[model samples]
Target: MTIHELSPQRSAALTGVIPPVSTPLTPDYEVDTASLTRLVDHLLAGGVDGLFVLGSTSEVAFLPDSHRKIVLDTVTHHVAGQVPVLAGVIDMTALRVLDHARVAVEAGVDGLVATAPFYTRTHPAEIELHFRTIAAQTGLPLYAYDLPVSVHSKLGGDLLLELASDGVLAGVKDSSGDEGALRGVILGRRDRRDIASFSVLTGSELTVETALWMGADGVVPGLGNVDPHGYARLFRAASNGDWEAARAEQERLLQLFELVNVGRPRMGLGSSALGAFKAALYLRGIIDHPTTAVPQIPLNDDEIARVGKYLSASGLL
Candidate 1:
């Protein structure tokens, strides 16, 4: 049986608010260790259950290999295991992902999150082998990041459930944005046979209450990087069965989510998002610089002012 089956309690502990952390960069695009240190402390102070590094929100697609290592090492060192750190080993193929996995393992991360092989038309069986191969190579627990928009493939509930049952997957971070499909996976894991432990974490930050109410184990909200306390409160309220309070918190977060849209038309979605996240952090004085990776448009003063307004209205300022 899988380790999760052998230790069911450990699986239960995986549930809660785990935010996908944004990598704070210096003006020259280097990883700002000081800002990152502050960011981790910020999350922990907000009572986050865990930290996720090298995710889409961290601009993993734009970071080079050296920068990726810096981010993993810096975050893992700062977090110091106070809470579990799940590192994203995202790549275009299984072999490429293993390279990242090895680094994460050496960095002392608690878990690995990977996307299905992308940039090539891969068969379903290959995809299955992809996850199984990675799991076999690294003894660390594996999480499937189901981000269809980025991976160009949607992992069906049946496949994910089967993987979890067989011990190849420990959890899923569903960024697919398809509520019905995610609910299917959530409910399937509940009804599926021989699946002892699995986590269902939603990446859609806007409707966290609905996601939690539908039985998601937790959230990996990108917005959580900006206001970890808000997400934490939402999770606590939901866990306490305070749906009314949870709904109110989620509504406020929905308003905060609007900050991401402050940079549009002049930049791509990815640029806008990373820029907005760093900009918000800067406005809050959590980070010194709001520099995004190359090729991503920076938020102008006017756009950043809009982000400040969103933060103020949400009471973050």
Candidate 2:
């Protein structure tokens, strides 16, 4: 596959609500291309600025290489340049991540997102070298994913700024849930005269309004898969400086986020939350089956009912 390049103008437009889109699967755990296309259409119609595939919300870690390729191919082909498609090359090291990054680049993804290496104990200097090396090798716009819960490493604001200044990172996806760190990155981008157009997107769904107010360029909410229009409305409200409207919308979305808690006591955090997102999508008829990958428990009938209640209460059903 031939890798295409994105113009500076096109790369600069990577802002607003870009969902870490879920990878729909058949009962046999095969990639459901048709359903994935539908989901992309759903998000595009809802006014999202871009599509992020194979991220945490997409269950990238669980997907086999073939399934990951299927997802990247399907979304990139379907989107057809209507919006930027950012693919996540998540792995435990630079070499493995580069393999996936090559595939994404060949698939014509607008950019790549990856977190610091995991599984083995690594140093901050190593993490910096990891990103710098990947950026140099791929020659594609790279975004640092600060997902401490999953990656086990919190990408500090200082490192993030240094990367931006050095042109090693095009942006950052801060899911660390640390308000101080998030603010630091946002402020760093704002105050830095050398780094221009470094996007700082918040993956903190519960506080989209707050992140935006704190100078975040956009949001990559997992809940956006369930309620894309809602996030779109919230983004526009906040971006327009209408805090009152943004607050109301965000509060409603926060209520919707409560659905993730429905599976907490019985299932692991990933199982419960991801299953709820899939279940909600299934219940809304957006996808065929809510079945997640193996080893991760699926939401039972009772828990699925709770998801429906959340949608209904949010005026989605």
Candidate 3:
């Protein structure tokens, strides 16, 4: 299908939650479609604005292309228009990303969330060209995913505006965690407003309110994989300018994020953020097991105990 006029169809106005959903797997490590479907349905009921499938939390690197297609098709068909769907296209090469975007759109995705090309550090101009090329190829609204720590590209304000002027670049997921950098993008290049507008979304729980105050449209949080309802409420509070309520919810979510995230000293590097999320999911009885693909370890006993205690204290379980 030829696509044009790439305006965002997502809830990109910063008032709801969108979870980077986990890819449920069986004991043999095959993608468990039924479990994944149930998890998606559960989050939808919990009031998530949409689903970001095959995200970093989903271990997209572990799944082969064939498996990715299966998950994408299943999700798009099963969703049946209940909520918008965004497919993660995290690839090391622009050509590979373009192929993934084409297939995802054909499978009926509403939009695409593409990470900067990893495996190499490139100049800002190179990064802009890479994204512009991809956006030009696919008509889907492209969210510039600025996860510098993961993908090694820092999306600057001028570059963001440049991509936006080309029409395919829709908004940004500012996982950079730099409040100043996010604000620059939000305030940068107002002249390009004719092409499309950029919405800044944050990855750090520490800077969500800051991002929202700076005009972020919404969040694509990893923790939302397990705590959709809490995030939904939090987003609503932030949107309505309910600072007190939003602050309280942010504190609660930050606590949960720290307990499971590997960046915390209590957990260490070998830990899987994905596993910690699945552990929380199991506690909630949302999924059957905390399964991971090859080379990714499951959460240990101490980690499980820590998660259980934290969730209990927060009454999330």
Candidate 4:
């Protein structure tokens, strides 16, 4: 069922470890459907509650529109509603975002995740209008993807809270890298919102335990592509109030997260991070080929070995 259906089960699907899945590509950089299926199965076996496709980690912007549809159709059909599927509509305008949203809906996603219009100057009013228009046009559960890194616009806690209260948003995926802002939104959701089911998920993998403690609903860690089981365990520990276990898990996961840094010396942040994830997955034998989309520099043999060391240290290998 779509998130708009709002059944008891649907309300609950928005919570827990929903990873922004990495896109697996063939050696020639096509969407590897077989590898994609295996990755989905790997995540399901790892006990993830849901999946967020076409996000930053998924290389949505680098993907041509055709490949984006391939990913949506492949994931949505393969998942078969085992869990809610939230797909990103990352674009530069509301109308352009709506174009992607239509495909997401056609592909059978349960919800839509979008960011503020980017590649141009925008005001808070335009940002709000962007989301409002998408929500009205799509009629799906709309999620605000607050990532200042790519969109270059920070969405404040106040605007998100207002949208949530206004019934234009179903939840938020805050990758804005602002911890204090995240806490403000979580607390506001807890204390001010009339709706009890509005989810507040953080993209900060390292601080997920603390975010949960502060009343955030769940997490969407890109690192989860390599270690979904670890993240799932951490979320459960936090949910059960075992702060000690949560911290231990978070620390271990942070160690695994160090792999992202291994490639930083030679590549841009996105390339290094994305390449490291694919290398880890390839080492784990999850995805057959670890070829990243161009022109993101692919990790060399040396970099892949470094990634293995990080995975080995974190018990991912």
Candidate 5:
């Protein structure tokens, strides 16, 4: 149960399409371990370079402590060092995040991903302090997650670079959708001599190709959970300098990404997207159920049909 060696060395750098994997749930909303194992197999079979558990796509914000532990344990145990498993320590504050990070480390994640503290107003200085404290306390490599929509505060490029230079962070998982800022981070790392081996991964699924073209190190596309092969192919094509093939693959994925919107009219954003992913997994027979966590609307039969259409159109069916 203790998988300490999975932690990345100081010099280790993560790259390629790492999916923020979905947490498969049963009808009663328990963490379906069998389904989760199958999901992990599905992604690995599709050739993903790494796996991210407890991320937004995995409904980290909604899961209780027990549920989160089950997810982390299941993923790391099943992965068994095959690929790096980055666990998200998403909570409302530094102390809470540290607690989660400790659990994740004990569970044997290769790295930790965290968003800026949310629910309470936070200043730039507090955000910097937050990461610095976590980095100092936990020896595991840490990646800052920039998700303004959920965290309510954007990680500024200056703050991020400062932390990177000080060795407080290994990289950033940017989902802020700010291309200019993303480019700045990419270029800053390139130009800074003090910052070493910082991996920049874009969480923007739709703009993955552009992010690559802009010199991003990798991608953490949530959609990769649904089609890891497509994202892996896209990453390979881009990394190999085949822009045309990469573009084609990216466009195809963009079309597939439209499934996230199918339930928007009847549910919240998380509900629609997560529901769509689970639905896709179910349709593919990768998971047993498509039920999302409570308080989030589940896709009705009609919405599920829309997901099917997107899958069939994308040749996944």
Candidate 6:
């Protein structure tokens, strides 16, 4: 669909199984164009509704701006009308983020995933202003990405509603795993003043069914990258009001998370989660190897072994 503006309804329609897709790389750690195309095709064919380019899984922070642009262009091109491609417009500063948003616009992305600013201690008011400025510049519907554990600011529902009131952000992907906070964003305003039919996506696949049940309009999950069918099943079951089926799938996913996320540390390094996820994909024969960029530490044999064991025991291998 030749979309010029970010379509919230269109996005929701593509929501059930959106993968925070990995940035495919060659052995030497270059963007593997062929692999990326194949990966996108595989995901779409395997039942992923859409794809998220440059998310945590995509290693946006590790990639240079130019490479980020190329990655966006490649994914958007390969998506080729089969599904919407949401590009992550994450950067160090507001100006740079605006620049990235412009790149996303030029690259033909369906939407922009703008996470909270990191490194600096940004206040709630300033965070509000930052999103306002970026939204004013891009005019693309923005998906507020709130992974407080990874970013600069801790988001509350009040801040999200404030931004939505200004038409600055269209929706949120609350990776914070705080159900109450997510609920606030969803039920913050009923007047539909600024943005009518606002959206909120849950980034926590482990609790995505719960989030959706709690009023999340969409879900953008990392685990969906590895197991799109499973996530899709969960989303469909939830939407169909099949509580029993949804609960069953959720239990299965929780079991998987317990295995993969066991003993995983919370660090700002950006490599830990990505490494494990890539290794999981590798073990599943989805990728060749898990090659992180410079300054990003590669998972040692022990860590890989843990991930391997997790997958094998879960019967994913």
> Across residues 264-309, which tens digit of lDDT does each residue of candidate 2 receive?
8888888999999999999999999998998899899999999999
Model 4 TM-score on a 0 to 1 scale: 0.95
Q: What local lDDT does model 1 show for residue 5?
A: 25
lDDT of 4 by residue, 1-317 (tens): 22233311224327999999899999998999999999999999999999999999999989999999999999999999999999999999988888898889899998899999999899999999988888877777888899898888999888988888777888899898798999888778776635566788999978999888988889999999999999999999989999999999999998889888777778888899999999999999999998999999999999999999998888777
Candidate 6 residue 11 C-alpha distance from true site, Å: 8.0
What is the number of residue pairs that collide in model 4? 0
Clash list (residue pairs), candidate 5: none
* Residue-by-residue lDDT tens digits, candidate 1, 1-317: 12222221125427899998999999899999999999999889999999999999999998899999998999888888799999999999988998998898889999999999999998889899999988888888899999889888999899998888888889999999999999998788776556647888899999789999998999999998899999999999999999999999999999889888888988888889889999999999999999998989999999999999999999999
Superposed model 4: Cα runs more than 4 Å off: 1-13
- Residue 176 accuracy (lDDT) in model 3: 83
Q: Per-residue lDDT for 303 in model 5?
A: 92
| Model 2, residue 82: C-alpha shift (Å) | 0.5
Span of 10 residues, lowest total lDDT, candidate 5:
1-10
- Model 5 stretches astray by more than 4 angstroms: 1-9
Model 3 residue runs over 4 Å out of place are: 1-15, 189-192, 261-270
Per-residue lDDT of model 3, residues 210-284, tens digit only: 677677777888788788888888888888999789888888888877656632454445345777887888778
Query: What digit string (tens of lDDT, one per residue) describes model 6 on residues 32-108?
Result: 77767777876886687778899887888788887898899899887887887888999766887877888888998
- Please give the lDDT score at residue 69 for candidate 3: 91
Q: Report the C-alpha displacement of residue 51, candidate 6, in angstroms.
A: 1.6
Q: What residue pairs clash in candidate 1, if any at all?
A: none
Instruction: Give the C-alpha lDDT of model 1.
Output: 0.89
TM-score of each: 0.96, 0.96, 0.90, 0.95, 0.96, 0.87
Query: lDDT tens digits, residues 179-210, model 5?
Result: 99999999888877777588899999988889
